[model samples]
Target: MSKWAYSTDGFDRIVHRIDGVETVTYAIGQGEPLVYFHGGGTFHGFEWVRPLAGEFRVFCPYHPNFGESGDAELGGMGDYVAHYEMLFPALGLDTFHLCGASMGGHMAARYAAANPLDVEKLALVSPAGLKSDRASIPDFSKVAPQDIPAMFVADPAWVAPFWPADPSPEWAALRARESAAAFASREDLSLTDRALREGLKGFDRPTLLLWGENDRIVPLGYVPEWEAVLPHAELEIIPGGSHLLLDEFPAAVEALRSFLKG
Candidate 1:
């Protein structure tokens, strides 16, 4: 087993094989099901979903090629969407609330747009999909591993837990795998799919767009594009927040709680 395979309080760690890919999932809480797709570099564990356990059963899955999850034969966003199609049924989830961050947000949007009926509600935190002529996503490939944290959060301290003073060989290998997975997912330079934008217009499901006002990776300027595509989406911009707004700001969780409940 990998060093990051253990379960934490309120979350039961389990592995499920869906379509030949073994997926690591953290199941927590009790009420309605809330599937959470975490951001990049969060494959170790889901401390962010711990607070949401009070009201919902949050299932955080490590996407294929990330963490302990087995790699899929295919690549691209569609392959991921298809993986979840098989995964949801194996988990006995017919319909559930969906929440995703950054790259996960991009996947959630594509999933929800394709299977609107399966998603009761959708929450995207600083999502990466949706192209804006004015706003540009930073080239993470060019960023140094140590300096990458600053690009995600407004405060550098938020990433201290993930980056140890002296990382072991195993830890470094894990980080390398995560970085590779991220790049593989975006083989096409265009992260935002034009088809997804059109599909989102027809989603009609209750949607929430939570973003950091100061996000450097996926700028705040893309909010209008998202709003334009998802006409009914409720938009909330966190002040002084960056790409990792949910991590930097606790209020985003409360907002999510209220939105999910409402």
Candidate 2:
């Protein structure tokens, strides 16, 4: 059976082909549809979103060039936004809740801005894509492989799931692909999109900007730019949380749940 099957806690993993591109999708849970866009990493499924299955039919799709998903003719973040616009409808999602972190968050914001009618609500967790002259976002491409874990969370132990005990060749290959995709997608302004930043003002959806107070990858200084553009957005910061605030802090989940439910 698929790991994402309709069991009590499993997600149904399937190969969904959209526009000649084969994408891997994982779906589980009950209630309204909620799509999750993962950050820039070897697309390992997030365990933190499992609890949300009780309240939402969660759909997590590995973006092209990530995980088992096949590569596409994507050039930049704009291509990703356009790709999802087609993928969502092809997947029978007319309108749904959308959430994303890091680079995924950048995609979510642009998508919501472009297709406001498609998103019921929006949640951005330590999202990248906005340029801030005041603060510099760390260049992950320059970060050493051994020190990448520290860039994600304040506590190194929190990255236990990411660090494989038995480092297999397959695992290493997957990480390399993810890194390449991330680097390719963000060759401009270190992944910050001026167009997306300017477009945020047009998005009027009920949006939540969740961040880790101590985030090192995307600094807290970028919060103001997001807020200035997204007037309807609510900013919530998790104390001691790093770039991966959602995974490191339970309060982050609670905050998301409360916002989504409200």
Candidate 3:
């Protein structure tokens, strides 16, 4: 029997195919749909966001070529948007709350701007894609293995459960593969992509700009640009929060709950 067949933890995994490419998503909770897009970092699964299951049916799908998803020829982030064009309908995401973190936030922003789907509310956590001169994204490719986790969170201990103290060659290889996938799919990687920012100029929807005040990856310097593009969007910054604020701060979850409720 499928493990999901008898499981009752409000959790289940689904393997769905689109145009012959298979991607997996972990679903939890029981209510309206809330789709979360992950960042460029190594995605193991939901952590702090797991508590959200109590309120909505959260679907966290591994981007194609990342996590449990099968490989696909991705020309750029546009291709990722196209993938969701097919995947959303397949998964019954007609009118759902949308949330994306890090690189996932970039995709979510693009999708929300371009697609006419009913995104009741959009939540972006430390979104990338907006060009910034004052603060630049550090090259994770060049960062030493021992010092990488600190870039994602204010404290490194938060990631201890996910990353082994001593990563194996296999782990390093996986990180490289994921990094390559993100770099190749992103049309511009110098943290200077105006395509998404320009696209957002016309996007006037209820949005939540959630960020950690101390996010090292995408610094708070990008705030003005975000506010300019999404002038009507609400902004919530957590004190001493990191890029992975969703996992590092419980206040982040509470803020999400309060925003998603409205």
Candidate 4:
């Protein structure tokens, strides 16, 4: 299996029931707890984050209607926030570090804002929840499917390991399902909720805002939106990077490690 497939053999599998649906969580290592919210198929999966497992107990969860998690017909992203608010305590997480990327980042931001005191630190990587000026001509959704992968990373070769030489229908379906859920999680991509803004004002925890310099999906323009909401967050733009920051830049993971462990 390609490392990008990220085998779960060495990890501990934990299941927690929420809203009558069982959610799966894969955990590794033991130290300061660090929960990572994955963007799943949207950002693509890889083993790059495993290195952090050595120093932090990393929890990777599959959001409802995505991956191994059982399906749940939720209202919207706000419902997701409610699901996790219960899921966190059910997992016995009292206080912990949180990291989120892409769709997951958007979820993490809302989660931390609501429960800021439970999080000791927060990290957002290329989160989706804002509307920025169209970065690509005609926009990324209009691009051909085969060409879409190239837009995620500066070097297309980095994604070579992710594609199976002979992909099964099941594999393709899982990817499509995850992508759909990424969108369904948010009814609208705009983060202009007055309640959310007020919540963020009270979230005084340490925060990190990171983005790939060449991120075509979210674009650097959205960075300022996050900055306005989280003026205290530390911002870092990685060079030679794309939307798939972890895949294109080793520095992305290192920067995250430094921020979380600090």
* Cα RMSD, each candidate: 2.3, 3.0, 3.5, 2.5
| Model 1 regions more than 4 Å off | 1-7, 187-191
Best by TM-score: 1
Residue 258 displacement in candidate 3 (angstroms): 0.6
The deviation in Å at residue 261 for candidate 4 is 2.0
- Which candidate would rank higher by TM-score, 1 or 2? 1
Candidate 4 C-alpha lDDT tens digits along 98-207: 98887778788888987888899999999877655644212547788777767777887877556554556777878778777765665644453454566688578999
Cα error, residue 246 of model 2, in Å, equals 1.7
State residue 195's C-alpha deviation in candidate 4, in Å.
Answer: 5.2
> CA shift at 160, candidate 3, in angstroms?
2.1
Least accurate 10 contiguous residues by lDDT in model 2 = 1-10
lDDT of 1 by residue, 57-152 (tens): 998888988877887776778889999999998888999999999899989998998899999999999888777887988776788867876677
Compare the candidates by lDDT and give the number of the best one. 1
Lowest summed-lDDT stretch of 10 residues in model 3? 1-10
TM-score of 2: 0.91
The better-scoring model by TM-score among 3 and 4 is 3
lDDT digits (tens) for residues 1-262 of candidate 2? 4232123247788677877899988888898899989888743456677878899988888999997799886888888988888888778899999999988898788788788899999999988887788778776669886776777788877675565554567667888888889888874763446677666657878999999999998889989978887877999998888887776788998899899999
